[model samples]
Target: MEITNLETLPGKQIIAHFGLVSGSTVRAKHFGKDFLAGLKNIVGGELKSYTDLLNEARDEAINRMLNQAKSKGANAVINVRFSTSSVAQGASEIYCYGTAVKVS
Candidate 1:
């Protein structure tokens, strides 16, 4: 399904609004990755491990949100937004939300 951060899709018209749909997941850094990230911190470089982990989490959250929208018979999701917060010392929660809409 098409997803956008804009309130409405450019060329599509919203035919129905299905309120809100959301998905969230919490992920923790792997021990091995954490150890490597610590070493990288000393060199003051990008932490590729953590970056990959977060990217994966974001994709998972988006996929879940899309699934929910699809279940509601939505063809697209508008006003999509993402949020991230620390759930614990080494864990973080990723959330995605949007308005499910049937567009034509």
Candidate 2:
């Protein structure tokens, strides 16, 4: 399925809109990784562990959202959006959402 963050895709007309679809994944930081992150915090550098984890979560959520659209016979997903939240002290959730639609 094609996914776009824009309201519409260029060179194509939306023939029908299905409905809102969403997917989410939650991850927790490992204690070992947390200690490394804490050390990195002192130097104010990128937290590679969290970065990789979040990227994976984002992709997983998007994949699930796309699967949902496919199950509904949608050819594309429009106005895609991603969000992140901390559900617990060490856990974070990544969500992907969009409007399922048919396009030509």
Candidate 3:
């Protein structure tokens, strides 16, 4: 499905609105990754391990949201947004949401 942060998709007209759709995932830092991250922090560089984890989590959340929109007969999702929050001491939640719509 076409997903965009804009309220409207270029060259496409919204035919119907299916309210809101959302998906979320909670992920915890792996011990091995945490150890690597700590070492990277000491050197003050990018933490590849943690960065990969977040990227995967974000993709999963977006996929789930797209599935929900598809199930609702939506061809696209507009005004897509993402959020992140600490769910626990070591766990974080990634959420994606948007307005499901049919466009043509």
Candidate 4:
């Protein structure tokens, strides 16, 4: 399916609007990674562990969003957006949302 942050797809015409669709997931850092992050903080470098975690979360959220769009019989999703928030001490939420539409 085609997904874009813009209101409309570049070459496709939006024929039907199915309103809003969304997906989200929550994840927490592993203890080992937490310890590594602490050490990295002292040395001041990239946190690869956390980066990987967020990347995986983003993919999962996008897959879920696509599943929702497909279930709605939509060929595309427009105005796609992502949101991240801390829901707990070590856990964060990843959310993806968009307007489901049929394109032709």
Q: Taking the tens digit of each residue's C-alpha lDDT, what string does model 3 give over 1-104?
A: 99999999989999999999999999888798888887888889787777888899999999999999999999999999999999897688999999999998
How does residue 14 of candidate 3 score in lDDT?
A: 93
lDDT of 3 at 73: 97
Worst 10 residues of 4 by lDDT: 37-46
- Alpha-carbon shift of residue 14 in model 4 (angstroms): 0.9
Global lDDT of each candidate: 0.93, 0.92, 0.92, 0.93
In model 2, the worst 10-residue window by lDDT is 1-10
lDDT of 3 at 57: 94
What's the residue-level lDDT of 78 in candidate 3?
Answer: 98
When 2 and 4 are scored with lDDT, the better candidate is 4
Candidate 4 accuracy as lDDT: 0.93
Cα RMSD, model 4: 0.8
Over 1-104, each residue of candidate 4 has an lDDT whose tens digit, in order, gives: 99999999998888999999999999999899889988999989789999999999999999999999999999999999999999998788999999999999
* TM-score for each model: 0.97, 0.93, 0.95, 0.96
Candidate 1 lDDT by residue in tens digits, 35-102: 88888888987888888889999999999999999999999999999999998998989999999999
Clashes (backbone N, CA, C under 3 Å), per candidate, total 0, 0, 0, 0
Instruction: Judge candidate 4 at residue 102 and give its lDDT.
Output: 99
Clashing pairs in 2: none
lDDT of 4 at 45: 78
